[model samples]
Target: MKLSLFIFLAAAVLGPELCLATLHNITVKGELLCDNATVSNVKVELREHDTFDPDDTINAVHTDSSGRFEIFGEEDERKLTTFYLRIFHKCDATHPKVCTRATEYDVPEKKLDSVYDMGSISLNLQDNKELGRRYDRDSEECD
Candidate 1:
């Protein structure tokens, strides 16, 4: 029957569309750097901006010895997303100032239509000295 044939064709078309909307796993690999140099033991996080809580964190990762990191995630198309690579120096027990404050680097969101290869996402901690100075000024004023 023509009705049966039409129904079958409709299912075939709709099935692929439904599957395409599902999230696929992605691998993102990159180098972590500080002050334009390679850094080890850095923390990397894949955070989703939630509508309910703006400042709440979702997921996190850490870098290896060579400053290389890989994160597996499903790309979401509905919302604006970004991953952050955070760098922190190992601190001594007695001297807090010996370790630099944590710095965040933004990772570009992957698109749903394509696979993402992060390649080399470089970070520069010293490049924002002015921003750090501004923070110090605000803290001094608060005190």
Candidate 2:
């Protein structure tokens, strides 16, 4: 009974702090702009591929003074981890429109196996309707 009491006391003292291993580290880098002008100090959102709602974004990053950004996340032992990035910007303050990417970017499972680099994503901020195609090769939406 005394040994059990001692163990309980130790557990209470340690609290919930613990060290866990991180399996994979992923990095996605990109530049953001609206109508040929770089956008700075905007919140960049990273989300699991299936998360449709912006409020549930997993990670938030900010762009530099030059409108360049790098967002990263870690995964542990998951077979597949896909992510999508988005931003919120006003294309034209006088006009109202949606300013985010309509399609999500997919990171292959093999790449997520370790440290992965998604190089040079150039995103153009425009209305979804004006953007035309869903997966426009030129850019992604940021609204």
TM-score per prediction, in order, is 0.47, 0.51
Write candidate 1's Cα lDDT for 1-143 as tens digits.
99999999999988777665534344556776555666677666554445665633445667788878776665443345454444443321124333344555555555433445555545542452112422232343222
RMSD (Å) of each candidate, 1 decimal: 9.9, 9.0
The C-alpha stretches of model 2 lying farther than 4 A from their native spots are 1-22, 50-56, 77-79, 92-94, 97-104, 108-143
In order, candidate lDDTs are 0.52, 0.56
- How many angstroms is residue 61 displaced in model 2 relative to the true structure, after the best TM-score fit? 1.0
Worst 10 residues of 2 by lDDT: 127-136
Off by over 4 Å in 1: 1-26, 35-37, 55-58, 75-100, 110-115, 125-143
Question: Highest lDDT, which number?
Answer: 2
By how many angstroms RMSD does model 2 differ from the true structure?
A: 9.0
